[model samples]
Target: MNGQPFQTPVEYLKGVGTARAEVLKKELGVKTLGDLLQHFPFRHIDRTRFYKIKDVQDDLPYVQVIARVTRKEILGEKHTKRLVAQVQDDTGVMELVWFQGIKWVEKNLTAGKAYILFGKPGSFNGKAQMSHPEFDLYGSEAAQRKGNLTLQPVYSSTEKLKQFTLDSKGIQKLVVGLLDQFAREITENLPLYIVNKFKLMARADAYRNFHFPEDANKLAEARHRLKFEELFLLQLKLLKNKVLHTQKFKGAIFDKVGPFFNEFYAHKLPFELTNAQKRVLKEIRQDTQRGVQMNRLLQGDVGSGKTVVALMSMLIAIDNGFQTCIMAPTEILASQHYQTIKSLVGDGFIEVALLTGSVKTKDRKIIHQKLENGELKILIGTHALIEDKVQYQNLGMVVIDEQHRFGVEQRSKLWRKNVIPPHVLVMTATPIPRTLAMTLYGDLDVSVIDELPAGRKPIKTVHLYESSRLRMFGLMKEEIAKGRQIYIVYPLIQESEKLDLKNLMDGFETISREFPLPQYRISVVYGKIKAEEKEYEMQRFVRGETQIMVATTVIEVGVNVPNASVMIIENAERFGLSQLHQLRGRVGRGAEQSYCILMSKDKLSADGRIRLNTMVKTNNGFEIAETDLQLRGPGNIEGTQQSGLLDLKVSDLTTDQELLMLCRKCVEDIFAVDPQLAAPEHQVLNMAFQDKNAGLSWNKIS
Candidate 1:
């Protein structure tokens, strides 16, 4: 048997018939023998030592005892029914209970039969007992020797699987059967030289040890080998795609820092560029001048002056006699960018236009003419920028703000707008952890601006209970009296049964009653409102017509009010750390001292308490992001699942940062010598890449 044995339908296996195969496919996605082999255990138990029944303590993690079943009884009726068995070792006696599958237990358990019982110990009516424990017959000589097993792998199975006799033990037995039949048929994917260099265990040995380890050392070595293989294959694909992209796609060369960029830095720059910002600009300049398309990610925290760096880079493109564009995710953000860039460039130096869904038909016609006639130097808009009708004359560079909101297909459409894709710069205010960034955006260069501008004060954050409402109101009144604005954000637009948090409408009504009409004006905004109405309310708040904006998370990303000195989040415990940080960023835009009040109920879960305390402790976005990753794991992080790169089976992005770095270094070394993996010794890697990349789509934008 070769690879064909692994590919055989799981229904044909010795223990798995048609009935169990259906349940296995529906419950665990194990359709073929190979799928079953790859379903690694989530945890392992040490079964080498056995404890006496008298020594079993409630606090012990898990213990096994060799005992004889002396009696069995079925109690209760119908759904309330349960089966209990009295088992006695030489020293003491204990009880075993089963609430589910009582009929099966009543039929199988026999009196005067010696068995091995394994489970967590607990007390019931002053007697030791274990509910739903694992058991095996102890009379057989083979079973007696196997009872001293060093390690046992425990897999994840569903209750539905348990009904069909397909629990973790059943799955383990099936894997054991498969291994007995086909372990020797497993082929090596990595070259022997590389395996020797890393001192890795043989591929067959790794599979065997991962399922049934001989000792702790062998288990550790097995895990290391599998994790390295996973990370290495992923990195190899990304690097190969990058190398192929650079060689095939030609970019417009912006070889000179011409008068436009020079003039803006010399005279028009509003503030001195921070060292971090200067370094990022140098990187972008180098990419544009290299004559290859640049796919770079720009990460900066809120209020860190990213827009200024973006404007300066756009000016370089303009100086080289090519057009540029910036696409934001929302209409308000697009309009804000258009106004900011227009003001920065001043009146006659460059022609800039704003194109959005709300733009009038006649105005759009004029903008189109200017864009096609090479008169429009820059165009800024939301998704409207990618429309088929919008054409550009020599579009050189593209900048996307908050790029995660857009899908890969939507962004790739912009690349199709030009003959050769323009140098791409994707910017995000959400700080991603280094491990996550390397895995998600491995094919792109990354630049981060970590420092804030001079003369800026850190926002003061405080956690407040709901009982502190009056004091919070007093502080808001004081800020208002000082001629500043405020934002009061709620978590939901309407009340929900699943969540007991306050909604936007209730908060608006309460704030109105507290502050009254003539003295205080509040604007309400939410997702359900009409687009035109929402924009009108937002504009009113922007012009300072309203002293307070009571809204939902719709205002979390785009709204920027410099005079707003306070951010009050209602039921802050309901939000994640990242969202809380983004909401806190809405304020603290100006020189006035700013504050963020996190209002929550008095009682909170442990994780919720940690999230709130983290916000109150530091204003660093990266630090907050790392804590968020640890608390919520990578799956819950925003926009990460959509990338399709985090479908990891063994390695964890939160804890395996060092392993990921080492894998990257290995790829760099391998590529330095065999860029295409065409050497005879490297043929194994090339074949593996072909199999991995056959169905996978690599649509990274440049």
Candidate 2:
């Protein structure tokens, strides 16, 4: 690391002294010469050709041209300087106006002489004119292009910094001068086989071309190579972390389910478990008993019966005399899970306690005492479960519902609660794309329930334009007449805004005024409302006290009202595909034929159209999730990369799904043959890994 050149401050560069270096540092965060080399361009403008004045549209941007300055006129006095220079081409003559800097323009634009001018062409008073045009004498593409970067790298800076004369050109000048004296070629970090196979440019060549390219093609190639390396290194780091964690942690052994599972299976409750549920449970059982801590991700579409499998696993832990704690994102979900498990397990004195932030003072104290004493075996709650005070005597397993809703730190806190971290199981009803699943949960062993429960009905999805509002209402009335409750959900403009959409409120008012049933109550719930109020509204809908519920996406994740058969998503184009699927999952929980009406405005983008079409085509959340990944790519799912899973650049986990399979195969093959990458051919692999994990590495390379 110390051997590399241009690692020193920019002030030490050949052309850049203290003054310019201070401006560079303050403006672009480029204190070192290395920083300038890494500052890649946002985009580039092509000035390879000059357009004719006649050919240039009024709306198009103008370029430098050799034109005669026909006439010069001043329109304003001293302080308010206004001047115009009419420059003529063979085809036409356009007015070049300079409102503020007229004196400088007049001196340069001598009448009857050719001068180059650049600006945007605009029509004013039926004549083409440009404001404060950039002009130069005796200039052409070949001559002016030498010092300027071929790609024209745009550095990010603030307004104040720009005022200090630390612009892109200044940064470029400093970089070029430093590189001449200090730049030394570094060893290529990729294996020779990979470089040849991918036809990637050499690492040093890529770095040079990325900063000061001779052609657009070279610049593009350089960018692609760099982006690929960045993503690969990040992935390598994540995968390595997972490997280290698995090596260090050993989980509780639950190998023999002979007496416990056998007795439970003998009675078999009333109905048999689905093949999918059985398969997932077996996977979890195998993983848990393997001695290594089971960090498995359970992904299932809604109605796929993920909860049953989770419960069965908890039962296995409980039967083995180990306590289990299930954490939910919401109190309502916690309460619901507690009810389902209590009835299903029915093991008297097993001690299942419900703990949430909303629990009363005395009740909370009692729950806390019970948890600390190890009397509460399967304690379920929201984040309050990990609230410092809640202690488990023998916490064997931890199940997290809606895994994305919780922070990474929050999850880690729960794992370290016990001496030996509990075997972690993250459950999500929102099915993730397979490639994403690997990258995101590369650290965890993943088990999925792809098959839906046998008796569960598939929700029928339909897309409708806003023009069909009257027809949609008619269809809703028909569904309502059948004694089925309807949920009309409004999409929020922004996730944070409590009252962006009037649709939720308007829909509530409409139901109360127009569609009110004497016995069929209507309830409204949104993000603005208190959590207790939200729960109350959900409870009413659940207990069948409220026949219709008008709400926003607040009910997207945990609200489970099976009786609600109709889901009308207003302005569906505004919502993402995964979100729409989750909201649709809310309905179809019951037996009656469920339908989701996606009411989108006619004005929809191509991606928007695809999203709506994908929803209509399938009820499978995994399929929709895959489509969503393809459409949106993997920047951030559920907004702002909450999962911290695939923060990839060039590697599209969605589109590069097949390529990832190949990469995984390669990883397996390499690890199988040479676990430590110590082989002769793997020298470059070591280099790549070192570059990728530079920040985390403490090992010295000798």
Q: Which ten residues in a row have the lowest lDDT in candidate 2?
A: 693-702
TM-scores for candidates 1 onward, in order:
0.92, 0.82
Clashing pairs in 1: none
| Candidate closest to the true structure, highest TM-score | 1
Model 2 Cα lDDT, one tens digit per residue, 416-498: 88888888889988788887777767667788888877677788999998788788778777877787788988887675465
Candidate 1, lDDT over the whole model: 0.87
Count clashes in each candidate, considering only residues at least 3 apart in sequence or on different chains: 0, 0
- Give model 1 RMSD, 1 decimal: 3.3
Q: Residue-wise lDDT of candidate 1 within 508-600, one digit each (tens)? A: 778999999899999988777899899899999999999999888888888888999999999999999999999999999999999999999
* For model 1, the run of ten residues with the poorest summed lDDT: 693-702
Q: List the candidate 1 regions with Cα displacement exceeding 4 Å.
A: 1-4, 17-19, 59-61, 68-90, 95-115, 120-125, 130-139, 144-148, 493-502, 692-702
Give residue 604's error in model 1 in angstroms: 0.9
